[model samples]
Target chain A: MPLPGPLQDLVAEFQRLPGIGHKSAQRLGLHLMAQPVEAIERLASVLVSARRALSRCSVCHDLADGAICRICADPARDGGLLAVVSGTREVLALERTREFKGRYHVLGGLLSPLDGIGPEQLNIRTLLERLRDPALREVLLALEPTVEGEATTLYLSRLLVPMGLTCTRLASGLSAGAELDIVDEVTLARAFEGRRPIA
Target chain B: MLGGNAQGKTNLLEAVATLATAQPPFARKDAEVVRFGAKDAIIRSSLRRGGYPLRADLCFRTQGRRAAQIDGVPCRRMVDWLGKVTVVLFSRADLDLIQGSPQGRRQMLDRIIRQMAPLFHDEEARWSRLLVQRNALIRHILTGAATASQLEAWDEPFAVAAAAVSRRRAALVRSLAPRAERWLEVLSGGCEALGIGYKPGIPGGDESMSIEGPEFVASVLEALGKSRAQDLARGHATVGPHRDDWLARLDGRDAAGFASTGQRRSIVLALKLAERDLLREAVGEPPLLLLDDVLAELDPSRQEALLEAIGDGVQTFVTSTHLSDLHGAWRARADICQVAPGHIARPSVT
Candidate 1:
């Protein structure tokens, strides 16, 4: 027998996710159906409330409940240093490390010409606006090591250089705990390039 | 059971090569390898190396896709499974390395380098993707859909990836040149001195020096910047590792221009032998050698030199229409198998 319309719709939505095939989507849809009605109700409520609560922060374009994100709202964070990233996920990733005490500017996404994404499509205007602070000293690009990430970094650095702002990118090299023998030659070469001298 | 032309001798050898590399050595596309009236073709082999058993299965669909498995586990990516069963295929087409365009020689270098450094496959994939994306962006810039500033985004990464490829190619040539010289001297009875020179696409590259890491990346970026005007006009990347080539010089002269057919054959043989030696040293096991009806093309002396180079460690599979085509030593040491239409049989030694 054919699944009910809502169950079929749920299966289709599950299939839209990466790595979820028809069988897995169908199984997930069936599993959700077998659950108590209150469980589904709870899931729907949580999804709606999360959507309602979270909006992009006006300053950094990061997820926030208010107009400004917590990092931008915090008085202790250094406005002199701004870390630019591709998306909200990278903001969370950098936050997890607890490494930086500076503010952040999310570009929303990298500049991908083939995808019809350009400088105008990104949050670059706001980033430039944030950089208007005379106290802002350095702009750190925390982008991926992929081609798109590097390209975006290059583009931004070129733009920032004329503005007399210091621009830098996250160091790319072998990951911590990665064996030297297994690391790719490019990463190994980069590690050597970025090697720091000890006293 | 030996037959004439259009038989399955070369086909069987190609199947073995396919199993080893998950790619047919001769076919340009996967669909070309599939037989007429067949939707797909499967090549499976049970191999043993260093007392360890391995199985490789490759299926080529007519729809131009392939599926590969190693040891009964599906490979998520072809690059992950490639080089697991290393192979060195010697065919008549290898003559193209000398007589054909620079692409063939570059492919030879890339194949050997990929086997020695499996990570090279990943680097190569990234390089190709970057090249495509950069080219597309260039087109967009030409069409006024994008601005000149946008090119900067791709330039750095393209330079980095290009440097990675060119550095490895340069290193491979540096290592293989001497080995090739030694092999050629042996094969030519000390009559020829072969030199393999790496000519990176970067303008003003120092042929004698080895540059890696940041220095190489800087040179590539500079080259890209210099070529930006021309590339913008052409709507594609005209500079980088994709345009790199390795020159084969005999007695310090360009082998492509002056070497005879016989010398070219010997040079190719020497290069393959050098590849085998390097793979042995790198992987700790000699790679399988697939000689596809090449014995008939070589003279007896060259054939003898090839056999001497094979030595005892490497496992070799040679295919020929006639058993008499091979040297007596080959017949004596080889397990003779007769390949006929649609069938193969192992005949007892006479």
Candidate 2:
């Protein structure tokens, strides 16, 4: 049976979100309706406040509750080194490694021409502005090895290399402890192409 | 290769085709290509490519994509596994090239192109991806979730991919047309004329536009822009190379409209031969031809013509139910293997 007006409206709103189809939206709507009115109000307030409070970092463009993100504000992190990434998620992923002493510069997205994303659409200008800092000695491009990531890396390389910056891309290949046979072909092939001679 | 009806001759061909195309030719289910009792199957073959003997190993699991290796090195993609072991297969169903829908002819041409140039697989895959992404963007626009600017941003890359696919297909058809005509003359003993034309679905209907240059991309971009309203209405791309096709003419006449069965067979055979010659010329080696019980379908004279054309040094495997059906001349020099229920009796090569 068709849902009542307000329930249908809630389901429609849910359906607008990515990956939530009509059935899932309807289920979510019915489930939420069974909750207390205070519970729904609390959920709405939390979502609204979180979205309104979180803004981009002034320095690295990572998600920030204030003008500058925690990483940029941290004095222990190396200021001379910058790891360029495509999104805030990548910043979180790199932070989880616990090995990266440097700060991050998230461009928000890779250069995907097919998706209408180019240099202008990304935070490339801020990236260029950040590169002017003399303390920033080395730059590491921590982007995915996808076609868009490669294109963005190359574009950054052309812009930065002439300025005598030491720009490096992420090392792509089979991970440590991964089985040789189980490694994907693209990764294996990349490992071959990126092979270096050991002294 | 000699085998009776329901024997394992066709299965052998299907395995090789699967290895070359990354898709099984005759089976629907993924596991159907595997042996009836086996959990997995391994096809190991060694052939010389680019003047070096390369060994290819293909492993097909009951589920999941097949893995392929060339010279003990894994292929980066299934396309890399192609062009290593090329094949020219002509079966009874090949007559459908003329009679069937445009998709059949497109697929036949694409198969040959994919085998000859492995990167064609990459371009075709890219085109498919762009098409899907573009359609999704259009759907978003239709639903008011996105704006037209997003679709505009996607149009450039989509147009580039569409242009790339159409250009390669046009070039393939262009090269094959004359060769197919020449082969037709040779197959029909200089009496029949064949004409092959690429029918790309360019917006302005200028197939000649896609044949060359940067202008193809511009035209495709314009076409995509022009069809934006239609695409928005339909929630998909209304213009692209995915709907491309080629036409075959017999004796300077439209083969699809007026050709008889015998004429259709001759044209299809000629196209297959043209494909073989094109591969040979490009690769510097003739592809292995697999004739899977098609000799029995051809009349005696046409069969004689085909056998004569397939003459000499080219590696060929002709399957038949009886030895008498095969030419005596071929039998004198041929190493015939009789395929029975469970085994094939190996013949001693002269």
Candidate 3:
């Protein structure tokens, strides 16, 4: 027998989510239906409130619950160094490492003309304004090494580097924890070319 | 090389070709090409290219994409290894360039472009992916699942890929046409004239359909906009370079429409020779030529012309079943090999 109207709609909603296929969607919908009414009510409230509380940080465009994200408000970060990322996800990822002691500027996306993403569509205007902070001496392009990412980085560098700012990028080679045997030839070739001396 | 039907003559050429082809048609070791019971197949070659000895390896798995290693180093991206070993092939299937569907001609043209541009494969691959995505997005729009404004998300990328692919193809045909004309003249002793023209599928506001830069991409986007109704009805893309083709004109007339059998053979050979010349000029090194049963189709005089033109400039591999077809000077200079179903023997040091 087919699912009832509401349950079928629930399954369809689940299916629309990324990575959840038809089978998973059906299972999840049935499980949700089995939950207590109060528990389901609380879950829905949490989802809505969490979404409502969060906002894009005015400074960096990272996820924030207020006008400024914790990173932008933090006084301890190295103001001289600013890392420009294509998305706020990178900001969270880098923060988890606690290695980069600098503030960040999120473009929200990259410039991919074919994909209908252009300079105007991204958080690029804020990125340019952030560069005017005299304390910031260097901008690190923390973009993926993909064609669109490269194009965006190149576009930014051409626009910003001439303004007397030192620009840098993440080194591309074999990823950390990746074995030498499994490293790809292009990366291997680059690794060999960019090999550093052990002092 | 001498081999009967279904022998390993073409296999040797395919093995060499595997190292060069960006997308090996049989890379997924499934039917006829990979032996009936084999899980995987690998082809390895070491040869002098650009006067430097290079080692290339191609690995084909039953269920995954093919992998390659150059000098024993695994390629993370095949683009690094593609075009490193180029080959110009002439097989019985090549007759389709004049007689078969447009798809065959496009495949042959794309292979040449892939080798010449080096990045053409990546661009074309991207185009193919965007085509699928854009088609789905179009479907979504037609069904009210997505807004028309969201179409730009896929159209922009699709246009980029379409422009790049068609531009390279146009450039290749532009350069190839004159060279093929000259080669055809040489083969026919100035009796035949050839004209190759690339027909870009995009509208460019003129009779001439040449794919240029930004304007070409804008044209594609516009064409996509115009074709939205038709595309919606079909539930797929109906515009772009994916539908590009080239036409051959013999003596200022459509060759495919009314060319003699002998004249058609000469056209194919002229096209093949022109490809070899174009590749050599582009790469600064002659590519390996694989001729499989093509000699039998050409007349005796044309055969001599081909051999004389080749003159050992590039490494050439020829496979023939009839020994009588190959004569004195050519037979004397070539290293002969006997090919059977499962084995090959170096018979003589001719």
Candidate 4:
């Protein structure tokens, strides 16, 4: 009762997913095997096409089938108000909010000193080059509000300030409808320090 | 809250997890749980020995057809099946646990406890409901529809539930302290001392005045009466465990305000490891450990600590772009998966 080599590999592949266990992997493998050959071929084709067709966007390092992603190609976007992000998914995330009308520069990742992701590892050079274009004015950083994010923000501020572009980090404080008293001291302090008077 | 990047990884995890977690920092309600593309999403996980089957079915419509099922059976009540399955999810955003807000730390504590003690979840749910009702009553008082007298009536239930919550949190924090300190020492090489304390609003540590369901209610009522004007103006309950906080100290200094980024991350790792051990102690088995690209964020020493924590084979899931970021020990025990675009493959096995 030996399983086929391809089937065994497929089971092993399914086991690697986030929540799928060995039992679930076996079940998925069986289900895939039970599928019509055409469906299995279609799944394989879709995967291959996606891998072959999609690549990093030339300007922003986001996923794109062309040299430039649609966001970069869109002339309506305000390049001056560029939003610097960490991934292609982030670009789409901001777009879904429908609030940002600016172009983007995806850093691919933040500066994690422990992981050897220094300033050189990110697309900081390209980001600086984008800022130097004169059309870029404000660079909104929408990276996750983590320590690495803070490091990235500090690095960008130093790089962009000399170039005279205004740098901004996404506000990190209490969530909407949350109480001030319940919030931690650091968040409360940040809220106070970062507060602006109502005009 | 489902699609590409906003794929609701954190949100979904939170939604399912809240049932097992007590007095979470998020402090959200069931109504607030549904958003954008979902009408009502039900999370039904079964707790089993070692591993159990889980099914989460959302009852909604595309054109106009509503349906729900779990393991192929029509889902009746989502809560009925909770604690039936053990779930562990990993996401890149979990780096926040190591480098983000105190809310994350508090949540880590609550979630671990919820998985261990189901009664804590019930207590939290009841307390949350009471808090909301009390807040609404305060809003009414602001509008003159309710009086200060109304606050006394609500205080009984609010205080009773809030006391239960405060006691549980304080007890849990006490339990986690030793494990947390040990983990911090291992990760940071004795460079820092990590200590976490529950800062419940009530100061009465006396055994006689300690806490009981009725006494808690009466005490809360008195506090509400005292803060009536303030609560009315704010349109929310002002004095309760709902407004409590967890204080994290690194060498006796507030970790959030004073600790360096590296120090904060070390403390966070200590807290999570403490959670793993605490959950195992409570449940007689370790919960599934999820390391979402966090190995890359840790220093080599911290990475070793992480490897040791996750190496117990209590079932772990880790995601990383670079395979080399994984410690050699973890890689030895791990089954690697490569994810790109729409395809996920096991290239190593192939």
Candidate 5:
């Protein structure tokens, strides 16, 4: 069956979406046709508005309509404590904890050598630049504790420790409330190594 | 076109995705998805929700079986079966779930919403339709046939739809926060504070996720007015939830960058368990947990912990290349089945 001119183009476009198929494209086309003119008009308006409005923050690459993201904009954040993360979303995750009263540096990604994500591809330079701020105290390497994260952290620590910044890492071990025997060896080792002084 | 070694895994996954999303998975005319030297292929999958089962059967010639059924009854169109069954897949590629490209995370977030709220899939489709029109309008303007002044005409709808997507994701994440945190605690053993945050393309400027309904629409409109010129030169629009992502920070650090391999797996597992919890809370029941080759990746202890977390209630389908890896604990709870080249059998497990 031949679809009408505009409808055929619409179907083609619909098929380009994350998971829509040709049949779905037709259903959507028919659904669009069934809608009130205002609905169509309203949808069209929203699509344009969303595209035009959002921007990435200059400092963090986080979605921002302003010059800086809310986290970057907030004055209360401890400028001294920098939690290095991979992307804007992780920045949001830290913010939700309300536990970390520190500023963050979004790395944009981890160091994946196989996929060609190296130190240069990530925001390592920017992180180094962030250290220039005199108020900076600790550069908490907040990346995932993967080999890449470890490589990045080790790489950063080599640079950061010499710079005299208090380089700390998030503790790793068997999770609380989980069985000890089921914990992986590496985690078990980390648990023993990072064991704190008995209060 | 799919010829790489890793590509086969991706292709198989895509085929399943194509089936799940395409309403009548078998009705499509094109069936060249199989690899070379394979005489034929048969894809049989069932979509079930709320105990309602709809089956999709696709047979190929160069590719063999093509048929579909809803409730065991024959069906003609794929659309009839879509949105009836939903699956959420988080692969190793999801390492970027926190740290990689915004586009990757955006798709992940949308997938969560797409599963929970089917209408979101439709609304997103509608939004995409408008995006194409706006892009076409821009293309026309670039060619001097249309004026840039007309850009505002499209920005209005763009903002509204984008705002709707942002609000839905925000609300969904917000609603799921407690569960996410709880699951994180159980998975991580409460050592680190678990946090989940939503970075909206356009911030509502309020902390409690206040952006909802027309207010979000209004704010989005205001934003579109702000970024109009940048959109024209780029040949595409920037900003919005399409560009936003969820960030996970574990104990004041980036979960992706700071998390170890085992930690990343733990976090991802936590996320999966969180989704299970979220579904159970949002709806009254849990979706079947399909553990595909995940046990091999986990150590014996983590494996036991994982099984413990899943419990016995939720229906789970686990697959492994070897049975020894899954020995003890879960073996009894799971119905054992075996699969080999062109064969499947139920082997007794003592």
Candidate 6:
């Protein structure tokens, strides 16, 4: 027998996720159906509220609940040291380390020419606007270590140089606890080239 | 089971192997596999795995463009779709793994590693691209078209990617060495001991050091820096895992330089068996085995040993010029297929 209309719709929605296949989507839909009526209702309400409450920050373009994000509003954070990233997820990842007490400018997405994502498509203009402040001395590229990320970094670095701001990239090398024999060559080379002398 | 020489026997086996890995074992570029005067070629197969029927399609065009599809859905990334089907192929050229250039041995290691860890393909592809680009930058620097600082920008990523390739290659050799040794002993009737050692291309790397560890990347980076002047003179990047090799030893002697022809063949056979065993352990089921005119290369006793190694419950495809070249038992127990120009006779069930 065919699935009911609403259940079929739920399966179709689940299938739209990145890794979910048709079988898995069907299983997820059935699993959702088995949940208590109040639990389902609560999930739907939370989903709507989360989507409705979040908006892109006006200055940095990071996910914000208001016109400006908390980091941009915070005076304690270093406004001069701006870490440019691809998304809010990267901002959160950098935050977990607590290494940088600087503000972030999320590009919303990386520049992928093949995918039609160009400089104009991203939040690059807003980034340039934020950088116009003479107080912003350095721009740190906190992008993923990928070809696309590298291209975006290069493009942004060239743009930043004309503005007289120092451009830097996240140091890519061997991870902590990674062994010498198991480390990939690219990371190894990066670590070697990026090595600092011990005082 | 029976076909004349150069009658698509090897090509058929190559096609099956390509289906599983999305790469042609013998061709460095996909264009090399396409027929002369033909613009493109397609290899498609319907496979049944774990009670599920799946279809794989690979399209190869000139100038190195290719596409892959699984179950009628195009795969955006080759890494995401690889390893859905596992295979082990034994060809006459496998003899080169022991007697030929280090490049061939490296390719052998890569094939096995790709099956063991599908993600290794992505790492290898990234490393390959970085190496090519870095070498091109070196050439540009040599010609005064680019600056030294431009080379500096590429060094870090090159080292990182190289370290990954070296590490994976080292780990694969470590895992495969003992298994190959065991198989060699069985194949040689416990008369010979085989040793397999990973010889990294980095200057300080040895059998004792872990090739995939953090220090390996550091050392490789240092080596690349040291070789920059030399590389600039030569107009290419010279040092890294692309030049790395694995040493096959027979009773502690370098097999490539000292082992007899029969010994080399034995080593190749043992490595294939070890590969099959490792794949079985990795996927929890035996992989399909493709033997392309390789059984005829082995003597009767070695052939019997090969048959014994295959055991039971494994799907195997063996191509040869004659049924007489195969074991008598294989002739009786296995279904027979005949191949001719542009034709393949269906397997006749006994």
What stretches of model 6 exceed 4 Å from their correct place?
Answer: A1-134, A142-144, A148-199, B63-65, B347-350
Which predicted model would earn the best lDDT?
A: 1
Candidate rank order under DockQ: 1, 3, 2, 6, 5, 4
For each candidate, what is the lDDT? 0.84, 0.80, 0.80, 0.66, 0.67, 0.84
- Is candidate 3 or 5 superior in DockQ? 3
Sorting all predicted structures by lDDT, with the top scorer first, yields 1, 6, 3, 2, 5, 4
State the lDDT of candidate 4 residue by residue for A49-142, as single tens digits: 9999999888888999988899889999988898889887788889999989998889989754334454567898887777778777788988
lDDT string for model 4 (B1-350, tens) is: 11133333344345444434312124454445445476654544453455555554444332333344556687443333344434343344545554465456556656665665556656676677667666765665566655555454456556666787777777788888889899898887777888777765544433234444566556665776777777777877777775556777888877777888778777777877887787777767776666655677887777877777666557665656566776687667777655544344664531
TM-score of chain B of 3: 0.92
Residues A20-66 of candidate 3: C-alpha lDDT, one tens digit per residue: 98999999999999999998999999999999999999899888999
Candidate 2 off by > 4 Å: A1-67, A70-85, A88-199, B26-32, B35-39, B48-53, B77-80, B322-327, B330-333, B347-350
What TM-score, over all chains together, does every model reach? 0.85, 0.68, 0.69, 0.52, 0.54, 0.70
| Clashing residue pairs for model 3 | A114-B156, A114-B157, A115-B157
Question: Across all candidates, what is each one's fraction of true contacts kept?
Answer: 0.67, 0.00, 0.00, 0.00, 0.00, 0.00
Displacement of the residue A108 alpha carbon in candidate 5, Å: 48
Q: What is the lDDT of candidate 1?
A: 0.84
Q: Against the true structure, whose DockQ is highest?
A: 1
- For model 5, the superposed segments whose C-alpha errors exceed 4 Å read A1-199, B1-68, B72-83, B86-90, B203-209, B348-350
TM-score for candidate 3, residues paired by index: 0.69
Q: After superposition, how far is residue B307 of candidate 6 from its true place, in Å?
A: 0.5
RMSD, candidate 4, Å: 25.2
What docking grade applies to model 6?
A: incorrect
State the DockQ of every prediction. Answer: 0.43, 0.06, 0.06, 0.01, 0.01, 0.04
Query: Per-residue lDDT of B287-321 in model 1, one digit per residue for the tens?
Result: 88989878888888888889988989778888777
**Candidate 4 — which residues are off by over 4 angstroms?**
A1-199, B1-48, B51-79, B87-102, B202-219, B341-343, B347-350
Q: Give one digit per residue, the lDDT tens place, for model 2 in B160-205.
A: 7788788888999999889889988987789877888887776655
Q: Give the TM-score of candidate 2.
A: 0.68
